[model samples]
Target: MGNEYRIALAGNPNTGKSTLFNALTGLRQHTGNWAGKTVSLAQGSVEYKNKTFQFIDLPGTYSLFSNSKDEEVARNYIVFEKPDVTLVVLDATSLERNFNLALQVLEMTKNVIICINLIDIAEKQGIEIKERLLTNRLGVPVIKISARNKIGFPLLLDTIDRIVTGAIECQPLVLQYPDEIEEKIRQIEPHVRAIVGDHVSARWVALRLLDGDESLLDEINRLITLKGAS
Candidate 1:
């Protein structure tokens, strides 16, 4: 992996995600924070048809549940950093929970690519994921890739370029949670601008806070303190 570019790979934990990431960037991986959150971020670069692709490997977590450190890390990057593009890598075998994270990411931002990995296992288990149906549902370019075999690398790279260049639009399906939670998110959305910006969806941040993320609370409290001083 040798190129000058930036990307972020996000997904739930234990999804063969790290293996796929290594396949994409190879020896060029590096680690750091996501600008504000102490949550660690890993990045690597690969030369894709004369274009350099840099990728940020996010901590794998189940859904965007803000109760843990990894969720906050990936959520903040998609919501605040608004990276050039976000790859929601999912384990094809576990669509239910894996998709839960993907759907959340979509709600927070527009640039997302779906990587359905481990199709081999899914087929072995007699599970068929109607790819076309899934694609139609996602409203974005979906790539069925076996990172181990490198089956769909070219398509993935091309899709990445399109998303980053704004040629392709990634739309999130607005999923309704429990009415009580939705009410809370609606209430909290307006209070986040002091800490984030217009580039992010306030409702997503509000949901995270409602789920009780310590790091997010810390950030909001810090902002409140600063605002009081000013």
Candidate 2:
């Protein structure tokens, strides 16, 4: 792939994430499942501004912390692979409902771009999203788009290019847990940083540990080993 940057498309089901993926990649796409799992993974490549951007359409799920196999695949790929940018697709009509996953993803990675899909439907329903408010609240770039009609994609591409090229800087919002839990996280943070060494966010690792997500813990340890080897 010659140093292609990987962009992961993540969102709830029926948010039109697949449509955007197809539009961006065109014909250079492939479909398959994650190894040893039935959860499907779709990938494609697109060239923009002299750089190749690879897109991975993760299986749609309500939450990454869920027990579904699809959630497992999406969560692991993001945590382990650590894509260059995580494109979080949100439903404009139901921003509150879709914002849950976006918030979860923000806890994991800093490089995030939120795409508000289904703007046409939202407008028809008289629901309008304040892109600037959301962008400021999340501390990430939010692009309004109607993927089915291919509206606002040019600006989306430009934003992606700028982010990947370091022209745009992103500092994602951080979520604060309860005081007791925050105390525990502070204690565990040092240990996690010692092992992972910034390969991933230490606070995220601490949260996962507190949540008792053993599968993700195993994946994190494996990634730590690979990073150490490299």
Candidate 3:
């Protein structure tokens, strides 16, 4: 079978993420709990330009660094399965809080697209996000969409096509930290690189290590070891 691109819909709770997923796939989603876990998983198909995608709706969570099984399920998929794209559905009205999760995904992989949902609500509340500015800052394409009203989806799907086809590169936001922190990232990068796949950015993992995030380190190290064995 030809490759069907896989996408993970992830973001904070109540960002209209489920609404967006429903809107995208309508009633076609295959629902089940994540493997060996109780948290629900919604997988569906969306075809555009004669290309197909398998959308995986991750359980809503504030961040990936959680001990909760819901959070663990979401974190494990992105880190291990390494989906073709991860569409982070964030609320535009609350970018700062939503950004925390987006930053976490950046550490996992570059195949990320930030969907700034609730743009209409933000406008009504007089909160404006300079889409171009945010896109430029993150070095990734930012497609603003009001999922309920179905705005900018055509472009979003087109962007997804380009991403999965490797027609364009996804440049995830790799934020800068203090000089000392940068030194740590540089120190840990080589070790991470030797173990992890080329698809994941080691510098991002390095920062996670400096922050003393054992879950992430252990996860990456384990993935690398598994990849080595195979």
Candidate 4:
């Protein structure tokens, strides 16, 4: 598995994630529904710089906090699968709105690359993103690309390869909630760590608990119950 870098493509709906996937893999791709749900997942492979990169295109979702099937699929995969890098595609025309999902993903995993997609459309609409400013704000590599036109892919692939090969380091900026919420997270984090055992972000788990995410709460309870039984 280490021989090939595993990448997860995550983003909001209409962010051109599929287009980016198709552009990367061209004809080497397959699709199937996520098990137990009707949401579809697409996987593709591309060879770049003597490395094979496997891309998993997750369902489009506005935010991971939502209980929708698409949101669950995207969130669970990032948390459980722990891909080498999660390339978050964002609509350049509506970046602020799309940043919500990007921030959520950043919470779950530090390995992230923000692909500000639809540059051509943004240009047409007289919208421009200060890549350097945004990159500084996010503390991650931001690649500007028009996936439809296949622009900026060489840099994108090079960045992905560099990050996967450990040539480039990414320390993503984590979000800070309100002081009360932060206190609650600090309280819940240790329990989450005890249960998950570093399989996922304990801080993110704490945030989810505060948000009343039933799926995760149930999982935590189930794990605790199993631990007691054993």
Best by lDDT: 2
lDDT of 2 by residue, 113-197 (tens): 9999999999999987889998898889999999999999888888888888889899999998899999999999999899888
Q: How far off is residue 154 in model 3, in Å?
A: 1.2
Q: What is the C-alpha lDDT of each candidate?
A: 0.77, 0.88, 0.84, 0.88
Off by more than 4 A, model 3: 32-40, 197-199, 217-230
Candidate 4 runs further than 4 Å off: 32-40, 220-230
lDDT of 3 by residue, 26-125 (tens): 9778987665455678899998877788899988999887568678788888976788899999998889999999988987878889999999999999
Better of 1 and 4 by TM-score: 4
- Could you tell me how far off, in angstroms, the CA of residue 27 lies in candidate 3 after the best superposition? 1.3
* Local distance difference test, candidate 2: 0.88
RMSD of each: 3.6, 2.1, 2.3, 2.5
Ranked candidates (lDDT, high to low):
2, 4, 3, 1
Tens-place lDDT per residue, model 4, 64-176, is 87588778778888887799999999999888899999999989998899999999999999987899888888888999999999999999999999898888888889788
| TM-scores vs. true structure, each candidate | 0.82, 0.92, 0.88, 0.91
Error of 2 at 57 (Å): 0.6
lDDT of 1 by residue, 1-230 (tens): 33345777888777877888899888888887666455667788877668788788888888665666667667666665667788888888888878878888788787778889887888789988787677778787678888788777888998888776668777766778999988877777777754565756777777776777778667556755865799
Q: Report model 4's TM-score to 2 decimal places.
A: 0.91
Candidate 1: which pairs clash? 5-54, 7-54, 7-56, 13-61
Q: What is the Cα-based lDDT of residue 4 in candidate 2?
A: 76
